[model samples]
Target: MTNTQHEPRLFADEAAIRRVGEGLIARTLPREDWTHEAHLAACAWIVRMRPDIAPERDLPAIIAAYNEAVGGVNDDAQGYHETITQCFIRAVRLHLARAGQADLPTLVNGLLAAPEGQRDWPLGFYSRALLFSVAARRGWVEPDLAPLPTVMEA
Candidate 1:
């Protein structure tokens, strides 16, 4: 992966990372559908970033669940955000439960535990950073975490 001088720090702290995972779950639970690549990529990102949250062995089942949930749509454009978020959330929850953490549901549900309309800027920002970092690490795409477009020269 190419190093950037200004790479965004997504997992700056343990609580912050957990919050992002919870936010992902909160965004995913209500959705009825998902996408395969998006799910796989997201799960992979979470696992890569926080192996303790999700063991590598659980990836196959997580991917399978996402595939089954989507019903074989295979379209890249279908519910990108929801699917990705769900995959990360599911992976973490599955890992916690499988590892006997005893607080899986609480951690998963904590995202919505926050009051309505409360802005989770760090979670939102870091989620995107994690996605870009994972994509670049896996060579799936170029990493572009820039918040704004570059100014063009005449």
Candidate 2:
């Protein structure tokens, strides 16, 4: 679940989103700046601008490398999480499709305003215990609660 201790950070424009994405790609974003909102921002930027890199196929390595660069570990307990990353990527893709031709910042803001952008969104699909399990963290675990929806359901 998202750490609700802090308020969600909103991007002022596309440049803010691009900064998060490019920083993530370059492994240069400050670790503390990689908040949950920042994750969605980066995903939105990638989905909108870097079509050449399929997020589902390529983000795992990128995230893992970034974690290492930021002095974090990609172990079962922390760093890259396969299930969470994949789920958000799917959600971001759906948001992008729904937001055709919109500016990148608007697309991202719309996504952040959606229910799927909530940190606890996956909880609607997977049980808390299962979603937080090491197995789920290391690999994709089929949702144990309600099924994840297709883009058509968005």
Candidate 3:
């Protein structure tokens, strides 16, 4: 749960999402720029542009590497939250599917405008205690508040 409620930094075009995604992959993005909107934008870009990389299967490691590169840690208390990442992946994938074949900027912008794109979106499904727990950070923990959409639903 690296997200905090604040004004979103909207993407102006496909290039903006690309910069976040490419910078994240290369571990070159500045720590302060990895905002909640940026996280969703990067995930959307990865899900749409990079066919070889499966976000659900690979993003955890990618994020962990990026965290370390930015002088962050992936310990139990912080960094690389599995539950939140998986939830966002599902939400982004579903949003992408529903969006059909839109431009990256449109899709990213739309996502930022949706409920799931908000910094506190996961709170709708997870209790703060469970969502921010050490177990949740290290591995996926089932949402205690509500059931998120399943793969079939997505």
Candidate number that wins on lDDT, 1 or 2: 2
List candidate 1 segments past 4 Å from native.
1-61, 64-70, 79-102, 114-143, 146-154
Per-model TM values vs. the true structure: 0.28, 0.93, 0.92
Q: Which ten residues in a row have the lowest lDDT in candidate 2?
A: 1-10
* RMSD from true fold, candidate 1: 13.7
User: Candidate 3 — which pairs collide?
Assistant: none
**lDDT, candidates in the order shown:** 0.36, 0.87, 0.88
Residue ranges of candidate 2 with Cα displaced over 4 Å: 1-6
In model 3, the Cα lDDT at residue 10 comes to 84
The lDDT of model 2 is 0.87
lDDT of 1 by residue, 99-132 (tens): 3443333332332222210122223324566643
Candidate 3, TM-score vs. the true structure?
A: 0.92
lDDT of 2 at 13: 87
150, model 2: CA deviation in Å?
1.1
Residue 50 local lDDT, model 3? 97
> Residue 21 in model 3: shift from native, Å?
0.5
